[model samples]
Target: MNLDLLLEQVRSTSLLEWIAVTFGVSEVLLAKRNKVWLYPTGIISICCGAIVLIQAKLYAETILNAYYLGMSIYGWIKWKSRNQFGTPKITSSDSMDKVKTWGIVLIGWVVLYLFLINFTDSDVPIIDSLVSSTAWAGMWLLANRKVENWIWLNISNAIAIPLLFYKGLFMFGLLTVFLFVIAVLGYFDWRKILKEENNELQSV
Candidate 1:
């Protein structure tokens, strides 16, 4: 297979699409490095994605993309203000906090599913809702510099791959497939970075 063909397809995109892809690719790299700037980059990417999807007539995904744009903006501001000097301070939490966060995420997913069912006419409303809610949680957690965001990201991309294909976005489906693999690798990479940071702190 010619990888150049794939690159050409993406390269032929409109200006907004180009910006969207650039920001998205940057977000992925920044996310792997646990950088705070990823949130703002995400906002630009999602805004572009929303335009592309809406034009393509994938209403459910279009709405989700719009939501992502708003989410990225909110997350960017939140993350920027959360820590001193705008740097994420990696820290461990107790079991109770972890349980509470997970519980909240589960409940939020269920509620979001119900909400989408009431508002959207999509046949795959449940799956759509699940993906949106989970991705929202992942974005929120990432904004807070939480380690578990990777898990939610992995789950979201897992669902999104087939969903995009079903919606006839062959290129987007391929993109999500790539994202899924990257998310898995990102999980381990961030974990290792975190451990290394901890060890260096101990040594000092």
Candidate 2:
């Protein structure tokens, strides 16, 4: 698409879409810095996102956005829970976290794909389900403060970009692209933080 046409579509976006995109950007930026505030911002973003996806006939993403609302709440609570030193420290995934993450991805894909094929008039069931399934795994891991969450989120964002544009959600497609960049930065930043924390513990 031409720059002029893209700019026009952006200007023509609804107020709700603007809100969703704004908060969505904030959510990812805060998440990249490992802030607990990301969850609340994400809650606001996904609530609006759910409506936007519904209008675009992206049933899987709409459901995933709704699931994000609950996960945001759960993540907020979990992030606030304090350990002996402070709020729960960020860390890399362990064996069990990896297992559960994979389970969410596989099971989420199967169930969402079947639901879309049988119940919804969705034309992009495969890619749509892949987007949501990876996102589900990411959100679950994020609640546990796992560094690997960014990896899964970036995977979802990568798959979701073209699909969002194909559905004429140009604004959201752009947001996903921004999210992709942030998730990439978040992955490396979180890993660095984890290493620093581990070093501090060893020294203590």
Candidate 3:
């Protein structure tokens, strides 16, 4: 199958939208396998997302996408390191102290909500915050290799799909729906990996 056909769907869409979706799918695939390279893929999507949302006149999403770009850079650096083979492997999972994990989650959601509410006048204020916050948490969890990130991704997709479709981004919205299904499978897959790793460590 000529995957090039996918580009046709993008033809009617802006370049940024196409770029964002392509890279977003790539990021999700890389993330499913716990690859550190997901960060760069995410960065590509984030940059394009910012542009696409801005062009579409969705200022709040535009800003969030910019923030995503910045976060991607940080995540990339944090994940890059040598694995058992001394090859560059992004962290599959890390021991995040419970206190720090909750702290970051709390602070991130609060800040994202407050910023959106105060800075934007969209009728779907809470919905916007919900998607952005969920995505931020998911991204952070993904950076740490937490299996829980897929849960957040699923939540974000639920909100994003309708929102994008309503906003006239049919292609982007459809993509989010596809992502949601993929994420569900990813959750189970990652959980299995984590369990196997834990069992191996216990045996060792």
TM-scores of the models, in the order given: 0.77, 0.97, 0.79
TM-score of 3: 0.79
Ranked candidates, highest lDDT first = 2, 3, 1
Worst 10 residues of 3 by lDDT: 87-96
Tens digit of lDDT per residue, candidate 2, span 1-204? 899997899888888899999999999999998899999888888988888888888999999998899899999998888878889888888998899999999999999999999999999999999999999999999998999999999899999999988988889999999999999999999999999999999999
lDDT of 3 by residue, 1-204 (tens): 256755655567877787888888888888777777888888888887887776665665666677677777877776775567553332243455345545655676677667767876566666666777677777666666677778876887898888987787867887798799889988998888877877876899
Q: lDDT of all the models against the reference? A: 0.71, 0.92, 0.73
lDDT of 3 at 169: 83
- Model 2 spans with C-alpha error above 4 angstroms: none
Q: Residue-wise lDDT of candidate 1 within 109-189, one digit each (tens)?
A: 687667657765657767776777677667666656667778888888898888876775556667677777778888888
Which regions of candidate 1 are displaced past 4 Å?
1-19, 55-67, 78-86
Q: Which residue window of length 10 is worst by lDDT in model 2?
A: 47-56
Better of 1 and 3 by TM-score: 3
How far out, in Å, is residue 108 in model 2?
Answer: 0.3
Cα displacement (angstroms), candidate 3, residue 64, comes to: 2.7
